[model samples]
Each structure stands twice: as C-alpha cells, then as structure tokens.
Target: MDMDIQPPRRTFIRQMAASGALLGVAGLSGCTASGVAEEVAPGFRHGVASGDPLADRVILWTRVTPAHDGEGDVAVRWQLATDAAMRQVIAHGSVVTSAQRDYTVKVDAAGLLPGHVYYYQFAVDGGDKSVVGRTKTLARGDAKQVRLAVFSCSNYPAGYFNVYADAARQDNIDAALHIGDYIYEYESTGYACGQAEALGRVSEPRDVLLRLEDYRRRYAQYRADPDLQAVHAAMPFIAVWDDHEFADDTWRDGSVDHKTSQYGPFELRKHAALTAYHEWMPIRVPDASAPDKIYRSFDFGGIVSLHMLDTRLIGRDQQLMLSSYYDEHRRFDVEKYKHDVCSPRRQMMGHEQMAWLEEQVSRSTARWQMLGQQVLMARMEYPTAVVMGECSPTNYCALKKRAEADPSCVNEKEQRWLSAQTLPCYLDSWDGYQADREQVFAMMRKHRKNLVVLAGDTHNAWASDLRDAEGRQAGVEFATASVSSPGMEGGYPGRDPDDVAAMMVDLIEPLYYAQTSKRGYMIVTASHEQVRCDWRFVDTVFQHEFTAATERSLRVLPGPGNRRIEECYG
Candidate 1:
C-alpha cells in the first residue's frame, strides 16, 4: 500500500464542498470580471453553532473576522426564530466582540419552548449575515425518546471529518455529544500526520500549541473545516474536553507532554487552553469564578439525566505508569503495582465533583442515568503479557493451539506467560483508579439508578459490561470511535484489525464488542424502557467521497438488578 499518496488540497476541498461540506475560504473567494482581486467582506466566516442546551435556552456562537487587521471591536446582532427564513423571530439580541475575545461571539438565547427547534443567524451593522444554524431545546416534561450523536478524538490533520458530516444529515438526532479531544494541540508534524501534507490538512501555526493565541488559532482552523461547520450548523453540541484538548495524558496540574523547563509553567498553559475553549465552544460555564469546573448535568424531561464529567483537568491525580514498578533486575512487581493502583487516596474526580455527581443522580427522577464522560469506566483487563504487547494475537493463537494439543509440550515459562495475571491495558482510563471507580459504583448502587455510560477517547468503538471490584454488575458503557485518529491498528503494524479485535474480546472478560480500526461515531437513543447505541462507521476519511454504515448495535434495558449489554433485536 502506498502511504504517501493523497488527494490535492484544491481537489479535496472541491469534492467536499460538492458533497455538502462547507466551502473553504479559498473556494468561497473569487476575482471580479476585470480580473482584479475582490476583497472578502467582513462576516461570520467561521459559521454559526449552538450547544449546551437546556429546557429554556441554548448557547449560540459565531466568529466575525474584520476585513483588515487592527480593526476595533465589531458590533454584531443575533436573532432566533421558529422558521428558517427568520421572519417569525422569538428572541433577538446584540453584542460587541473585540480582539480580546478573538472576535468570537457567544449568546445564551433564553425563553425557548421545551423540546422545540429554532433557527438562528448572526449579522453585522451593514447587513452581512451568517449561515443559519439549527438547534433544539431539551424536553421538559415527558420525552418518550431522545437521540444523541456522539463523537470524539477529532484530529484535524489526520483526515476529513466525514463522521461529523454524515451525522449532520441524519434525522431525529436531538443534539451532538462531543465527549472529548475536540481539538488536538499537536503540531502539524506530530502524532497522526503521516498524510497531512499530502491531504493539505496541516495544522496551523506549524508548531505545538502553548500560548493563548496558539490555542485560539488551532480552534479556528478546526472550526473552519467544512464538515465540522456543517455538523455544528445542523445541531447543538454538548462537549467536554479530554487530554488532547490541553495536552496528552493530562492530569490536574501537569501532563506527560508538557515540559515546564521549555513551556514555562503548566498552570499558564492550562489557563490559556481553557480560555480559548470557552471562547470558541458554545458551552455554558458552570461557574463564572472557576472556569475549570465544567462538570454538569442535563435532564431530558423525565427520561434521562445526562451527566457530563471532567476526568482530565480538574481533579485527576497523576496516572500510574507500569514501567515505574520495575525492580533492579528488570522484573515487574505486579503485586506492588496493584496495591498502589488500588490506593484510596488516588483521585480521578476530586471530592467536590464526586459530591456534586451524587447529588445530581440522587435528586433526579429520570428513568435513565447516563454519564457522558471522556474515559472508559469498564474493566478491560487482559493478560499481563498481552497488555505489555509481548504477546501478539497470532502468537497467542499459536500458543493456545500447542497447549491444547499436548499439556506436557508447553514449558513452565511458556505456561506462566500464557496464564499470566490480568491487568488493565491503559492506566490513563478508569482502570487505573479502581478505588475511585468503586466509589462511583457504590453511589449508583445506593441510588438504584439504571446507569448507561457514554465514553470516548480510545479512538476505537467498544461495548463493555461495567463491573465493580466485587464482581457485581454496575452498568454498561458504549464507547465511540474517533472521528479521524487511528485506533489499535496503528499500534500493531501489518496485523489484521479483525483478528486483533477478536483477540481483545477473548482476553478481556468485560469487553463485549470491539472494533480496533475504524473512523466513526455512535448514536445513543434513550427511552423509558432501554438505551440503545448504534456504532456508525465511515468507509473512508482519506477522501471526501465516502459511505457510512451501522457497524454494530447494542442496548441495555432499565432494570432493578440487571444492567448489562445485549444485542439489539429488531
């Protein structure tokens, strides 16, 4: 396979525009009849978006670029209507945006009817208008059904955002749920940039993001993506940030990717990232004083209570690394590693967030308790050798065959390797914080809630049965795949993705389904009876032309004792 070949930027953009993607700035520009360059007008070039919806309101956002640099603050007007033509306006407002806000405007339009759709648009004093945006308010009394389009790990330079585009065209989707990794902070040459240059998808600024302006520029670049703009324009988004939004493997105070010696201080970087995030995303700040506190709950009538959590930034302790448990002889101390990982002092969500979650869950009378979080909360334990990548799928199959053929043929060392104790593969997930996970399970069990967890960040689709340390069923988790980032297939070169996925399911007891190599999203539907998740995959992200299909569907029924995933029938 030729890895370097990719479609040209102009051709890609043209095809995307034809296929319903928003036109790139270059595509939107043109010359006059006399051949003189025509100046682009000042308007809402970044497109309009709405998010963080409530029963009575939704946040609307847009960015107005001045015709020239150094222009003073720009006055913008906004209107919300029940019709697309903006003739029957229900709410209208005006705001002033300056360079301090990066020329971005956000408005929380209130006085909306519950479970209703509204059309919104922004304009300048001279009558320049933005693309009309569509958003829906949450249901207030009785929502028999609510559907959400879930997405994550959208690396702009990796490939086209066909997943977002496909979801934009779908019907009956109440809103979009961006669990995390909304914008990656890597440089153009970092991570999954193998074909970025060929596809004309290079990251702007050409460097790793650090300061306020750097983060803002990255957000601008991503929002300018036609597919991304189309999705934001089509539906409201409920978002929370994962590690890549700030830095990879981010904790409360620092990250593995950050170097204080070079980047100065992690605190300043975090502040800048958060500032840019708040400015660009249409999210309602949970607290005006503490911008970092973004963990909040949303109720859909009496059917579901969706709790979006902040597992990366606010209260997470440093993640545990297995390499740190190596002894003098280069032997791993598994017992010690387990003990440290099970320590009660280790926190994933701090005391304050946990208390708040308990209160929300306890007070809600909804039929379903859905946690829209960033990381997996299920037990994904594999054999130590497999977790450490010492045993490939092919190798494991061969060993199993030999062991079944003759017991005496396998040596003691091989037996130990084959029957190795199981452990979590990624310490960055909830598996690393067993004590904290158990605390959450205890709270859910106490409230007798029918838990359905929606998670992303693995860049792979997964369905797992969540279990507590006591081996009791806790809930079911549906983890969506990445929008473009590579999955487990990237880690194992030349291996079949299907084989890898099968091996994972065979080794991990809690994992019911897994797709290791795919770029896609999931649609989670909640009702009074059950919650169903359908994983949808795009055929290709390397090109604008593509097809989307439902790869898998599973559901969990509302129960007093049972809370496990089962195949969705009919």
Candidate 2:
C-alpha cells in the first residue's frame, strides 16, 4: 500500500488516538469491578445509535457531552434490555471516553439471539439517562424478509433531513443502508454549497472544513438535527462513504478539489477526515492488518447477503477528465479515447478487493446477492441532441465555457465532436470504468448470481437494468434519491424534473424509471423469492411534517424465473 495513501498500523492508530480515538476502557475498570460507576458529564445529547448487526452481535454508540464546554473525560454506563422500559437488562457495560475520542462511547454487545429486537440506553452516574433506542440483530437462518431503508447524500445545509425522520417513523425497516456521501465537505457559500441560503440552513463553522475539529463539529451539527437523530435512535445503519465525506471527487491517493500547496499535506487531511468518520460512525474498526477494509459482507440468513462495497476511497482511481484528455490529444480522438479511457488496466475496485468480492460472491450461499455501494452501475450514454434538448442553456453555457478553457476543444475536430456528442459517460460514475464494469458482469455471469445493486450519490432516483455488453441482463439496480442534496432537476434550473426524468429514461435503454427532483430514500425488501424496492419521496424537507409518497415500486425475482425488474403495483 502507498504509505502516503495508507500509513503503517501502529503509527496510524496512535495518530488517530491522539487526534480523538484515545478511548480507554481501563479507566472505568475500577468502577465496574466495584459495581459502582459514576458518570462525569451530562446525558446523551447526540442520541443513541446501533449498526453492523450480526447474527449475535451489534455495535451500539452514543456521545456524552458535558453541560459545560472544555470538560475532559466521562465514564458512561450503557445497558441493553429486551423490554422498552429497561427493567429487563440483558447486557450492560461501562466505558471511558475522553476529549480525545470526542466523548463518544461505543460497545459491541454480543451473545444475543438472532433476529431479536433489543432496546438500549446510556446513563451518566447519578445524572440522566439517554432515550432508549431500538435495534435488531441480523437473522441467523432463513429469514422471511430483510428490509433495508436505503439513504445517501444528506447535505446538512442543503435542506432538512425530513427523509431521515420519515425513515424513523417506518415500522418495517430492519437496517438502514447508507451508501455514502453522508456529509459534505463544502462550506456554506453560494459557489460551494448550492442551496444553503435558499433552504435557510447553515452548517457549523460557516467555512470549509480542514481540521479534525471542523469535521467533528460538522458531525455534531448534523447529529443535532432531530430528524437525523430520530433515525439513528430508531434503527441500525450499515454505511459506506462516498466522495463528499472527504472532499469532492476523491480517490485513493488524492482529490480533484484539494491542492496540497493550500491544504498542506493530502495524507494528513485524509487521515483527519477518516478518523472523524470512524469516531462518529457506529461501525466496527476493520482489521488492523488491512486498515482500509470497510468493504465487507453481511449474511442475512440464507435469504440475502449484503456486500457493502467501498467504491470511493479504498481503491478507486482518479476520475477521467474529458478536458484533460482532449487537451492531451489536441482534438477529439475516438479511437484513442476508447483505448486509453476504456483500458482494462484502469480499475475501480483495486485488484485485491476485486478478487475478494469475486471470492465472496462465489462463496455466498444466500438466495439473493445485494451490492450496497455508491454511484450508478447501469450504462448511461449521452448524445449531444438529447443533452441539448433536456439540459438548460446554462448547462450548455457551462460546457461551452469548459471547452473554451481547454485548448483541444478550440480546434475544428474537437469542436465538431463536441457539437455531435457530449462524452457518452459521466467520468465520476461507474460509466467511467467500463472495463471494471465488464469484469463485474463477467463475474456475475460466471457465478450465475441473482444480484440487486443498491446505489446512491447521484442524488436522483433511478431504476435500471444491469446489462452486459451483449445486452444480457445481469441484475437490477435501484439508485436512490438524496436525503436532502440537490438532484438532476436542481442542476438543470429551467427544465422540468419530470420531463428530465422522462428524457433520461428515454435516452438510456437500460434505464426504465427516473425521479430527478425528489429528496428522499428507498425502502428495499428482500426475501427468498424477490428483492423489491420502494422509491419514496418526501413532499418537502424544509419543514417537520412527514409527507411522503411511494414514487415507484420495482421488483426483481432471482434466478431463471426473472432476469429483469418489473413494476410492482401491489
């Protein structure tokens, strides 16, 4: 591994600990041994959360903020109960959290029955107790259904997190699958964040986040939202991060948005962002040997198996920039573009991860295979006419300006090609990694798998057929709209979102449905027979009212019975 990208274990661990991961359970060992623990701070204010549910284990988390600022460490006690009233304490423990770990406490409560519901709470010694949170463990054997409330791209300053509130109220959600872009890195400015002023939402710090404190403060601000807190308190979440968690369009080594000269060292900044992510999230630390091992598999009995992939940070290469390509060639070279850009050497999931994914798929005994990841998987080709017709003049003007800024687009051949077609793919998405996409499809075919891909980061709802080069259907994808971030409709100001959605579906053969302007999440139900997804949209996020509608319901049955997704009305 690149030391710049991934540091050594002991060094990295110590760095994180000093930065905030300095959590020591030994500090509370005396109180626990004596059976008398004391809480040093106020009660939980960030709310309680649970995640990474296994057959017999689940990780529980909560933060203990003192009544006064600048307090040091707090020893908080937590208890898990079978009943909501906390009278039936099944599992309990005391942990030490200091200013280093940002006063957050996490406990992995094991030795629980599978598919069982448990309630938990944290209390300060001689102080107050947190609100009880309900969590469920993953089923052990054959589960009738695995319901996942899928969410992503929740920009704190863009609007309200009404979708999170709505998901909290939902009774059937087994686990919340957050496919990244959990928090944005941009500041609360017009040029950086699009809708902060328009939505009347202000992110804390009021500027770009650079230091660890800034990232922690941002997490605090977001978690402070009642809707977001409600969702965390209600259900366990399986999350994977996307680009905005660190910076815009980030990859393994660097980011398009960051300049080392201005931002200091890239490695330091990345380490800070990742450390905060680990501290705030209710996730288990990956293997110390690997370090960057967020990509893991979860078995939901024999019915479904979820493969939560890390598509952004772990191994992704830098995105292909069309301007850069054009500038290099001094004109549009179709053959060169296809050769260089579509080469098999270009990888999305690095070699080790790819092998691991393939091995996991082959070893999976579940009836349905689900890939919970970021970005769209389906092929999206853009012809210039369709782009011109659907997109606003401002969009064309931006493109025109970009072309003007590049030396290649000034030439006649490049200009002609630009007039004829806008590059047929979004370089930031899976469309840019055709060779990798083909490899995945080949793996799917070889394993004869029944796949259901869960995607986010586009900030728009999409239902597409995952087809191979021969147009053979490999799986079905349900890409969710954002929890609050702006979508395709927001990108194209004057055009109707509905019309844009319709146009996209029309333009892309595999894409069957699209909802470009809604802000909400997806509810996916998986069973032995089929995996169904309900694309739900909230009426608005600027208010507290939970007004929602099922935008569409799409389902795909496994195996030879069904290969394509069908609209499920009932």
Give me the candidate number with maximum lDDT: 1
Candidate 2 has a TM-score of 0.86
Backbone clash count, each prediction separately = 0, 2
Each candidate structure's TM-score, on Cα atoms with residue i matched to residue i, is 0.93, 0.86
Per-residue accuracy of model 2 over 395-435 as CA lDDT, tens digit each: 44445566878855565644653567444458778888878
Tens digits of lDDT, candidate 1, 1-570: 111122223332233346443444553344221111235567766788999999999999999866655568899999999876677999999999988998899999998999999988899987788877789999986788999999999998899998887887777789999999999999888999999988878888689999998898888778877678878988899999999989999999999999999999999999999999999999999899999999999999899999999999999999999888888998888888999888999999999999999999999999899999999998888778776677865676677779989978998877987778788758999989889899999999999999999999999999999889888998999999999999999788898889889877877889999999999999999998889999988888999888788878999998866689999888
Cα miss at 113, model 2 (Å)? 0.4
